[model samples]
Target: MGRLAVGGTRDSVGVLCQVLKTGVPSALLTSLSLAQNNLGHLSAMYIGDALAAPALKRLRKLDLHLNRLGDRGVASLAEGISAGGGMPCLDELYLGYNKIGDAGARAVAGCLEGMVVLRELDLASNAIGNEGALAFAMHLSDEGRDEERMSHVRPRLLLETLDLKENRIGDDGACAFRDFLACAGEHESGMGGGRTEEEKIGLYCPKLLNIFLDQNRAIRARGRNALQVLHTTRGIRCMEGADW
Candidate 1:
Protein backbone atom coordinates (compact mmCIF):
# COMPACT_ATOMS: atom_id res chain seq x y z
CA MET A 1 0.00 0.00 0.00
CA GLY A 2 1.04 3.64 -0.38
CA ARG A 3 -0.24 6.04 2.28
CA LEU A 4 -2.56 4.50 4.83
CA ALA A 5 -4.15 7.54 6.42
CA VAL A 6 -6.77 6.34 8.85
CA GLY A 7 -6.78 9.44 10.96
CA GLY A 8 -9.82 10.47 13.00
CA THR A 9 -11.25 6.99 12.75
CA ARG A 10 -11.40 6.35 16.46
CA ASP A 11 -13.57 3.28 16.31
CA SER A 12 -11.68 1.47 13.56
CA VAL A 13 -8.12 1.67 14.89
CA GLY A 14 -8.34 -1.81 16.38
CA VAL A 15 -9.14 -3.22 12.99
CA LEU A 16 -6.32 -1.19 11.47
CA CYS A 17 -3.91 -2.62 14.00
CA GLN A 18 -5.05 -6.12 13.15
CA VAL A 19 -4.46 -5.44 9.48
CA LEU A 20 -1.02 -4.01 10.23
CA LYS A 21 -0.24 -7.10 12.31
CA THR A 22 -1.45 -9.69 9.81
CA GLY A 23 -0.96 -7.99 6.46
CA VAL A 24 1.60 -5.68 4.79
CA PRO A 25 5.24 -6.42 3.94
CA SER A 26 8.59 -4.70 4.08
CA ALA A 27 9.14 -1.72 1.76
CA LEU A 28 5.50 -1.71 0.71
CA LEU A 29 4.18 1.12 2.84
CA THR A 30 5.62 4.60 2.86
CA SER A 31 3.45 6.63 5.19
CA LEU A 32 0.88 5.95 7.90
CA SER A 33 -1.28 8.43 9.77
CA LEU A 34 -3.48 7.66 12.79
CA ALA A 35 -3.93 11.12 14.21
CA GLN A 36 -6.85 12.15 16.36
CA ASN A 37 -7.78 8.54 17.01
CA ASN A 38 -8.37 8.78 20.79
CA LEU A 39 -5.62 6.23 21.21
CA GLY A 40 -4.19 5.41 24.61
CA HIS A 41 -0.91 3.88 25.80
CA LEU A 42 -1.95 0.34 24.90
CA SER A 43 -2.72 1.31 21.36
CA ALA A 44 0.56 3.17 21.12
CA MET A 45 2.36 0.00 22.26
CA TYR A 46 0.82 -1.99 19.45
CA ILE A 47 1.66 0.67 16.90
CA GLY A 48 5.24 0.77 18.08
CA ASP A 49 5.50 -2.99 17.65
CA ALA A 50 4.04 -2.64 14.20
CA LEU A 51 6.63 -0.03 13.35
CA ALA A 52 9.39 -2.46 14.29
CA ALA A 53 7.98 -5.28 12.24
CA PRO A 54 9.53 -6.05 8.85
CA ALA A 55 6.31 -4.99 7.13
CA LEU A 56 6.59 -1.40 8.33
CA LYS A 57 10.35 -0.99 8.48
CA ARG A 58 10.33 1.07 5.32
CA LEU A 59 7.69 3.47 6.49
CA ARG A 60 8.93 7.04 6.10
CA LYS A 61 6.34 9.11 7.93
CA LEU A 62 4.08 8.33 10.91
CA ASP A 63 1.44 10.56 12.46
CA LEU A 64 0.03 9.88 15.94
CA HIS A 65 -0.85 13.34 17.08
CA LEU A 66 -3.83 14.63 19.05
CA ASN A 67 -4.12 11.50 21.17
CA ARG A 68 -3.99 10.63 24.86
CA LEU A 69 -0.74 8.67 24.86
CA GLY A 70 0.73 9.70 28.17
CA ASP A 71 4.28 9.17 29.42
CA ARG A 72 3.73 5.47 29.87
CA GLY A 73 2.38 5.11 26.38
CA VAL A 74 5.23 7.00 24.77
CA ALA A 75 7.76 5.01 26.79
CA SER A 76 6.18 1.78 25.70
CA LEU A 77 6.46 2.91 22.10
CA ALA A 78 10.11 3.73 22.55
CA GLU A 79 10.79 0.38 24.17
CA GLY A 80 9.06 -1.43 21.33
CA ILE A 81 11.13 0.38 18.73
CA SER A 82 14.39 -0.26 20.56
CA ALA A 83 13.70 -3.92 21.14
CA GLY A 84 12.51 -4.68 17.64
CA GLY A 85 15.32 -2.74 15.88
CA GLY A 86 12.85 -1.41 13.36
CA MET A 87 11.81 1.71 11.49
CA PRO A 88 15.28 2.13 10.11
CA CYS A 89 14.04 4.31 7.26
CA LEU A 90 11.48 6.39 9.13
CA ASP A 91 11.97 10.10 8.40
CA GLU A 92 9.25 12.03 10.21
CA LEU A 93 7.32 11.34 13.44
CA TYR A 94 4.41 13.37 14.77
CA LEU A 95 3.35 12.88 18.40
CA GLY A 96 2.00 16.25 19.42
CA TYR A 97 -0.74 16.63 22.05
CA ASN A 98 0.10 13.32 23.68
CA LYS A 99 0.33 14.54 27.29
CA ILE A 100 3.91 13.30 27.44
CA GLY A 101 6.15 14.45 30.30
CA ASP A 102 9.83 14.23 31.19
CA ALA A 103 10.07 10.44 31.38
CA GLY A 104 8.45 10.04 27.99
CA ALA A 105 10.69 12.69 26.48
CA ARG A 106 13.74 10.83 27.77
CA ALA A 107 12.50 7.63 26.19
CA VAL A 108 12.05 9.44 22.89
CA ALA A 109 15.60 10.73 23.07
CA GLY A 110 16.84 7.19 23.53
CA CYS A 111 14.70 5.99 20.67
CA LEU A 112 16.10 8.73 18.44
CA GLU A 113 19.58 7.32 18.93
CA GLY A 114 18.75 4.52 16.51
CA MET A 115 16.76 6.48 13.93
CA VAL A 116 19.71 7.52 11.85
CA VAL A 117 17.64 8.70 8.91
CA LEU A 118 14.94 10.50 10.83
CA ARG A 119 14.78 14.15 9.85
CA GLU A 120 11.80 15.70 11.61
CA LEU A 121 10.18 15.10 15.02
CA ASP A 122 7.12 16.84 16.41
CA LEU A 123 6.42 16.87 20.15
CA ALA A 124 4.44 20.05 20.43
CA SER A 125 1.70 20.66 23.01
CA ASN A 126 3.10 18.06 25.39
CA ALA A 127 4.44 18.32 28.96
CA ILE A 128 8.18 18.23 28.28
CA GLY A 129 10.32 20.29 30.66
CA ASN A 130 14.01 21.09 31.09
CA GLU A 131 14.98 17.50 31.89
CA GLY A 132 13.41 16.26 28.69
CA ALA A 133 14.83 19.08 26.58
CA LEU A 134 18.28 18.52 28.05
CA ALA A 135 18.07 14.85 27.11
CA PHE A 136 17.34 15.82 23.53
CA ALA A 137 20.18 18.32 23.50
CA MET A 138 22.63 15.78 24.90
CA HIS A 139 21.85 13.22 22.21
CA LEU A 140 21.78 15.79 19.43
CA SER A 141 25.06 17.48 20.43
CA ASP A 142 27.16 14.64 21.81
CA GLU A 143 30.36 14.26 19.71
CA GLY A 144 31.83 11.36 21.62
CA ARG A 145 34.75 11.82 24.00
CA ASP A 146 36.54 8.69 22.75
CA GLU A 147 36.58 6.51 19.69
CA GLU A 148 35.26 3.41 21.45
CA ARG A 149 32.21 5.22 22.73
CA MET A 150 31.74 7.02 19.44
CA SER A 151 31.77 3.76 17.59
CA HIS A 152 29.01 2.41 19.79
CA VAL A 153 26.75 5.46 20.09
CA ARG A 154 26.48 8.00 17.26
CA PRO A 155 24.79 11.35 17.48
CA ARG A 156 21.59 12.08 15.56
CA LEU A 157 22.81 14.80 13.22
CA LEU A 158 20.26 14.29 10.49
CA LEU A 159 17.45 15.94 12.42
CA GLU A 160 16.38 19.15 10.69
CA THR A 161 13.22 20.23 12.46
CA LEU A 162 12.32 19.93 16.18
CA ASP A 163 8.96 21.14 17.45
CA LEU A 164 8.78 21.66 21.22
CA LYS A 165 6.28 24.44 21.47
CA GLU A 166 3.64 24.85 24.21
CA ASN A 167 5.63 22.83 26.72
CA ARG A 168 7.07 23.54 30.18
CA ILE A 169 10.55 24.38 28.95
CA GLY A 170 12.20 27.25 30.79
CA ASP A 171 15.59 28.99 30.78
CA ASP A 172 17.57 25.79 31.30
CA GLY A 173 16.00 24.06 28.35
CA ALA A 174 16.48 27.11 26.16
CA CYS A 175 20.13 27.28 27.17
CA ALA A 176 20.58 23.63 26.27
CA PHE A 177 19.27 24.40 22.80
CA ARG A 178 21.77 27.23 22.51
CA ASP A 179 24.59 24.84 23.30
CA PHE A 180 23.26 22.47 20.68
CA LEU A 181 23.46 25.22 18.09
CA ALA A 182 27.01 26.02 19.09
CA CYS A 183 27.97 22.36 18.71
CA ALA A 184 26.35 22.26 15.30
CA GLY A 185 28.26 25.33 14.21
CA GLU A 186 31.54 23.87 15.39
CA HIS A 187 30.95 20.65 13.49
CA GLU A 188 29.83 22.46 10.37
CA SER A 189 32.99 24.59 10.37
CA GLY A 190 35.21 21.61 10.97
CA MET A 191 36.36 22.96 14.31
CA GLY A 192 36.24 19.42 15.68
CA GLY A 193 38.88 17.97 13.44
CA GLY A 194 40.02 14.39 12.69
CA ARG A 195 36.73 13.35 11.12
CA THR A 196 36.03 12.76 7.44
CA GLU A 197 34.17 15.37 5.39
CA GLU A 198 31.16 13.11 5.13
CA GLU A 199 31.04 12.70 8.90
CA LYS A 200 31.82 16.33 9.63
CA ILE A 201 29.56 18.04 7.09
CA GLY A 202 26.63 18.19 9.48
CA LEU A 203 27.60 16.73 12.80
CA TYR A 204 25.77 17.79 15.95
CA CYS A 205 22.61 18.60 14.06
CA PRO A 206 24.18 20.73 11.42
CA LYS A 207 21.14 20.35 9.22
CA LEU A 208 18.77 21.63 11.90
CA LEU A 209 17.19 24.50 9.97
CA ASN A 210 14.14 25.27 12.09
CA ILE A 211 13.32 25.05 15.80
CA PHE A 212 10.05 25.86 17.55
CA LEU A 213 10.12 26.95 21.21
CA ASP A 214 7.20 29.31 21.33
CA GLN A 215 4.54 29.56 24.05
CA ASN A 216 6.96 28.31 26.70
CA ARG A 217 6.05 30.92 29.29
CA ALA A 218 8.92 29.98 31.58
CA ILE A 219 11.65 31.12 29.18
CA ARG A 220 13.12 34.34 30.50
CA ALA A 221 15.08 37.15 28.91
CA ARG A 222 18.43 35.46 29.42
CA GLY A 223 17.41 32.34 27.55
CA ARG A 224 15.84 34.35 24.78
CA ASN A 225 18.96 36.47 24.40
CA ALA A 226 21.15 33.39 24.35
CA LEU A 227 19.18 31.92 21.47
CA GLN A 228 19.10 35.29 19.75
CA VAL A 229 22.88 35.25 19.42
CA LEU A 230 22.80 31.91 17.64
CA HIS A 231 19.94 33.01 15.44
CA THR A 232 21.97 35.92 14.20
CA THR A 233 25.31 34.11 14.03
CA ARG A 234 24.28 30.65 12.89
CA GLY A 235 21.54 31.85 10.57
CA ILE A 236 18.91 29.36 11.74
CA ARG A 237 15.20 30.07 12.18
CA CYS A 238 14.00 30.12 15.79
CA MET A 239 10.61 30.97 17.24
CA GLU A 240 10.72 31.31 21.03
CA GLY A 241 7.97 33.89 21.64
CA ALA A 242 7.05 37.51 21.09
CA ASP A 243 10.41 38.43 22.64
CA TRP A 244 12.17 37.01 19.61
Candidate 2:
Protein backbone atom coordinates (compact mmCIF):
# COMPACT_ATOMS: atom_id res chain seq x y z
CA MET A 1 0.00 0.00 0.00
CA GLY A 2 3.08 2.22 0.03
CA ARG A 3 6.04 3.13 -2.17
CA LEU A 4 9.14 0.97 -2.56
CA ALA A 5 12.38 2.62 -3.63
CA VAL A 6 15.45 0.39 -3.87
CA GLY A 7 17.58 1.97 -6.56
CA GLY A 8 21.37 1.47 -6.69
CA THR A 9 21.18 -1.75 -4.74
CA ARG A 10 23.18 -4.48 -6.38
CA ASP A 11 20.72 -7.10 -5.25
CA SER A 12 17.54 -5.20 -5.96
CA VAL A 13 16.55 -7.77 -8.55
CA GLY A 14 17.24 -10.48 -6.02
CA VAL A 15 15.03 -8.74 -3.51
CA LEU A 16 12.16 -8.61 -5.99
CA CYS A 17 12.76 -12.22 -7.00
CA GLN A 18 12.67 -13.23 -3.36
CA VAL A 19 9.39 -11.48 -2.87
CA LEU A 20 7.96 -13.10 -5.97
CA LYS A 21 9.24 -16.51 -4.93
CA THR A 22 7.71 -16.08 -1.49
CA GLY A 23 4.34 -15.07 -2.91
CA VAL A 24 4.08 -11.72 -1.23
CA PRO A 25 0.92 -9.72 -1.80
CA SER A 26 2.59 -7.26 -4.11
CA ALA A 27 -0.97 -6.34 -5.03
CA LEU A 28 -0.89 -3.98 -2.08
CA LEU A 29 2.31 -2.35 -3.23
CA THR A 30 1.42 0.88 -5.02
CA SER A 31 4.84 1.88 -6.32
CA LEU A 32 8.09 0.11 -7.19
CA SER A 33 11.31 1.95 -8.04
CA LEU A 34 14.35 0.18 -9.45
CA ALA A 35 16.19 3.22 -10.83
CA GLN A 36 19.93 3.33 -11.47
CA ASN A 37 20.43 -0.36 -10.83
CA ASN A 38 22.24 -1.27 -14.04
CA LEU A 39 19.54 -3.83 -14.63
CA GLY A 40 19.54 -5.46 -18.05
CA HIS A 41 17.47 -7.92 -20.00
CA LEU A 42 17.95 -10.72 -17.47
CA SER A 43 16.77 -8.58 -14.59
CA ALA A 44 13.88 -7.36 -16.70
CA MET A 45 12.83 -10.94 -17.41
CA TYR A 46 12.84 -11.68 -13.70
CA ILE A 47 10.78 -8.57 -13.03
CA GLY A 48 8.48 -9.53 -15.85
CA ASP A 49 7.79 -12.89 -14.27
CA ALA A 50 7.26 -11.30 -10.87
CA LEU A 51 4.70 -8.90 -12.26
CA ALA A 52 2.67 -11.85 -13.49
CA ALA A 53 1.65 -12.75 -9.97
CA PRO A 54 -1.99 -12.02 -9.27
CA ALA A 55 -0.94 -10.74 -5.89
CA LEU A 56 0.60 -7.69 -7.59
CA LYS A 57 -2.75 -6.38 -8.72
CA ARG A 58 -2.62 -3.02 -6.97
CA LEU A 59 0.67 -1.91 -8.51
CA ARG A 60 -0.11 1.53 -9.97
CA LYS A 61 3.34 3.04 -10.48
CA LEU A 62 6.51 1.40 -11.79
CA ASP A 63 9.95 3.00 -12.32
CA LEU A 64 12.60 1.26 -14.40
CA HIS A 65 14.73 4.26 -15.29
CA LEU A 66 18.46 4.25 -15.92
CA ASN A 67 18.66 0.59 -16.86
CA ARG A 68 19.89 -1.31 -19.90
CA LEU A 69 16.64 -2.99 -20.93
CA GLY A 70 17.08 -3.45 -24.66
CA ASP A 71 14.29 -4.01 -27.14
CA ARG A 72 13.99 -7.67 -26.18
CA GLY A 73 13.78 -6.83 -22.52
CA VAL A 74 11.20 -4.17 -23.26
CA ALA A 75 9.16 -6.57 -25.35
CA SER A 76 9.38 -9.26 -22.69
CA LEU A 77 8.23 -6.91 -19.97
CA ALA A 78 5.34 -5.66 -22.10
CA GLU A 79 4.25 -9.19 -22.84
CA GLY A 80 4.38 -10.13 -19.19
CA ILE A 81 2.34 -7.12 -18.15
CA SER A 82 -0.21 -7.75 -20.87
CA ALA A 83 -0.60 -11.44 -19.94
CA GLY A 84 -0.20 -11.09 -16.17
CA GLY A 85 -4.04 -10.64 -15.91
CA GLY A 86 -3.40 -8.22 -13.04
CA MET A 87 -1.86 -4.98 -14.35
CA PRO A 88 -5.21 -3.38 -14.99
CA CYS A 89 -4.71 -0.91 -12.15
CA LEU A 90 -1.39 0.42 -13.37
CA ASP A 91 -1.65 4.20 -14.05
CA GLU A 92 1.94 5.37 -14.34
CA LEU A 93 4.93 3.74 -16.05
CA TYR A 94 8.47 5.16 -16.28
CA LEU A 95 10.81 3.79 -18.91
CA GLY A 96 13.01 6.87 -19.23
CA TYR A 97 16.78 6.98 -19.69
CA ASN A 98 16.79 3.60 -21.36
CA LYS A 99 18.07 2.92 -24.86
CA ILE A 100 14.73 1.81 -26.23
CA GLY A 101 14.11 2.29 -29.94
CA ASP A 102 11.39 1.85 -32.54
CA ALA A 103 11.06 -1.88 -32.17
CA GLY A 104 10.54 -1.72 -28.41
CA ALA A 105 8.09 1.14 -28.73
CA ARG A 106 6.05 -0.74 -31.31
CA ALA A 107 6.04 -3.81 -29.09
CA VAL A 108 4.90 -1.76 -26.13
CA ALA A 109 2.08 -0.19 -28.12
CA GLY A 110 0.90 -3.57 -29.32
CA CYS A 111 1.10 -5.36 -25.98
CA LEU A 112 -0.51 -2.68 -23.78
CA GLU A 113 -3.52 -2.13 -25.99
CA GLY A 114 -5.91 -3.52 -23.39
CA MET A 115 -4.71 -1.50 -20.42
CA VAL A 116 -7.46 1.09 -20.39
CA VAL A 117 -6.62 2.68 -17.07
CA LEU A 118 -3.03 3.61 -17.85
CA ARG A 119 -2.85 7.41 -17.49
CA GLU A 120 0.76 8.53 -17.72
CA LEU A 121 3.50 6.98 -19.88
CA ASP A 122 7.04 8.34 -20.07
CA LEU A 123 9.42 7.32 -22.83
CA ALA A 124 11.94 10.16 -22.82
CA SER A 125 15.40 9.87 -24.33
CA ASN A 126 14.67 6.49 -25.91
CA ALA A 127 15.87 7.25 -29.45
CA ILE A 128 12.40 6.52 -30.73
CA GLY A 129 12.01 7.65 -34.34
CA ASN A 130 8.96 8.51 -36.43
CA GLU A 131 8.02 4.88 -36.80
CA GLY A 132 7.99 4.40 -33.05
CA ALA A 133 6.09 7.60 -32.40
CA LEU A 134 3.54 6.76 -35.06
CA ALA A 135 3.07 3.34 -33.53
CA PHE A 136 2.34 4.80 -30.12
CA ALA A 137 0.16 7.58 -31.45
CA MET A 138 -1.87 5.22 -33.59
CA HIS A 139 -2.00 2.49 -30.98
CA LEU A 140 -3.16 4.64 -28.07
CA SER A 141 -5.61 6.66 -30.12
CA ASP A 142 -7.45 3.94 -31.98
CA GLU A 143 -9.69 1.07 -31.10
CA GLY A 144 -9.98 -0.39 -34.59
CA ARG A 145 -10.45 0.64 -38.15
CA ASP A 146 -13.98 0.50 -39.51
CA GLU A 147 -13.90 -0.64 -43.09
CA GLU A 148 -17.48 0.45 -43.54
CA ARG A 149 -16.80 4.00 -42.40
CA MET A 150 -13.32 4.15 -43.86
CA SER A 151 -11.99 5.57 -40.61
CA HIS A 152 -10.84 4.65 -37.12
CA VAL A 153 -13.47 3.52 -34.63
CA ARG A 154 -12.62 4.25 -30.98
CA PRO A 155 -9.83 4.57 -28.42
CA ARG A 156 -9.28 2.65 -25.17
CA LEU A 157 -6.98 5.02 -23.29
CA LEU A 158 -7.76 7.24 -20.32
CA LEU A 159 -4.26 8.61 -20.62
CA GLU A 160 -3.75 12.17 -19.37
CA THR A 161 -0.01 12.69 -19.73
CA LEU A 162 2.71 11.40 -22.05
CA ASP A 163 6.42 12.30 -22.36
CA LEU A 164 8.44 11.87 -25.56
CA LYS A 165 11.20 14.41 -25.15
CA GLU A 166 14.61 14.02 -26.78
CA ASN A 167 13.51 11.37 -29.25
CA ARG A 168 13.44 11.24 -33.06
CA ILE A 169 9.78 11.88 -33.80
CA GLY A 170 9.58 13.45 -37.25
CA ASP A 171 7.02 14.99 -39.61
CA ASP A 172 5.17 11.79 -40.40
CA GLY A 173 4.77 11.03 -36.74
CA ALA A 174 3.62 14.57 -36.14
CA CYS A 175 0.96 14.17 -38.85
CA ALA A 176 -0.28 11.05 -37.14
CA PHE A 177 -0.59 12.98 -33.91
CA ARG A 178 -2.39 15.80 -35.66
CA ASP A 179 -4.97 13.43 -37.08
CA PHE A 180 -5.29 11.60 -33.79
CA LEU A 181 -5.85 14.81 -31.84
CA ALA A 182 -8.40 16.11 -34.30
CA CYS A 183 -10.36 12.89 -34.22
CA ALA A 184 -10.07 12.69 -30.46
CA GLY A 185 -11.47 16.18 -30.03
CA GLU A 186 -14.32 15.41 -32.38
CA HIS A 187 -15.16 12.31 -30.38
CA GLU A 188 -14.82 14.11 -27.04
CA SER A 189 -17.28 16.82 -28.03
CA GLY A 190 -20.23 14.40 -27.96
CA MET A 191 -20.44 14.30 -31.74
CA GLY A 192 -19.61 10.60 -32.04
CA GLY A 193 -22.06 7.89 -30.96
CA GLY A 194 -24.13 10.56 -29.16
CA ARG A 195 -22.35 9.67 -25.90
CA THR A 196 -22.11 11.96 -22.91
CA GLU A 197 -18.86 13.59 -21.86
CA GLU A 198 -18.25 11.07 -19.11
CA GLU A 199 -18.98 8.22 -21.48
CA LYS A 200 -16.60 9.69 -24.01
CA ILE A 201 -13.90 9.96 -21.38
CA GLY A 202 -14.53 6.43 -20.15
CA LEU A 203 -14.84 4.93 -23.58
CA TYR A 204 -12.70 6.64 -26.20
CA CYS A 205 -9.78 8.73 -25.00
CA PRO A 206 -10.88 12.32 -24.24
CA LYS A 207 -7.61 13.52 -25.72
CA LEU A 208 -4.74 13.88 -23.28
CA LEU A 209 -4.60 16.85 -20.93
CA ASN A 210 -0.83 17.22 -21.24
CA ILE A 211 1.86 15.80 -23.54
CA PHE A 212 5.62 16.36 -23.48
CA LEU A 213 7.29 16.25 -26.88
CA ASP A 214 10.00 18.70 -26.11
CA GLN A 215 13.52 18.58 -27.63
CA ASN A 216 12.65 16.48 -30.65
CA ARG A 217 14.36 18.93 -32.97
CA ALA A 218 13.37 17.11 -36.12
CA ILE A 219 9.73 17.91 -35.62
CA ARG A 220 10.64 21.55 -35.35
CA ALA A 221 12.57 21.46 -38.59
CA ARG A 222 10.15 19.46 -40.71
CA GLY A 223 6.76 19.20 -38.99
CA ARG A 224 6.22 22.74 -37.93
CA ASN A 225 2.89 22.91 -39.73
CA ALA A 226 1.53 19.83 -38.04
CA LEU A 227 2.81 21.02 -34.70
CA GLN A 228 1.11 24.34 -35.26
CA VAL A 229 -2.13 22.59 -36.05
CA LEU A 230 -1.83 20.61 -32.85
CA HIS A 231 -1.05 23.77 -30.88
CA THR A 232 -4.16 25.55 -32.12
CA THR A 233 -6.47 22.91 -30.76
CA ARG A 234 -8.45 23.97 -27.72
CA GLY A 235 -8.82 22.21 -24.36
CA ILE A 236 -5.70 20.00 -24.43
CA ARG A 237 -2.12 21.06 -23.73
CA CYS A 238 0.88 19.98 -25.83
CA MET A 239 4.49 20.68 -24.92
CA GLU A 240 7.26 21.00 -27.47
CA GLY A 241 10.76 22.44 -27.84
CA ALA A 242 11.70 24.52 -24.77
CA ASP A 243 8.12 25.11 -23.69
CA TRP A 244 6.15 22.92 -21.26
TM-score per candidate = 0.84, 0.81
> Residue 222's C-alpha lDDT in candidate 1?
83
lDDT of 2 by residue, 195-215 (tens): 665654433556466667777
lDDT of candidate model 2 versus the reference = 0.71
Model 2, runs deviating above 4 Å: 8-15, 143-155, 184-203, 240-244
Model 1 lDDT at residue 36? 87
Model 1: per-residue Cα lDDT over 146-176, one tens digit each: 3555655454557888899999999988888
Model number with the top lDDT: 1
Q: Which ten residues in a row have the lowest lDDT in candidate 1?
A: 143-152
TM-score of candidate 2 against the unseen true structure: 0.81
Count of backbone clashes for each model? 0, 3
TM-score, cand. 1 vs. native: 0.84
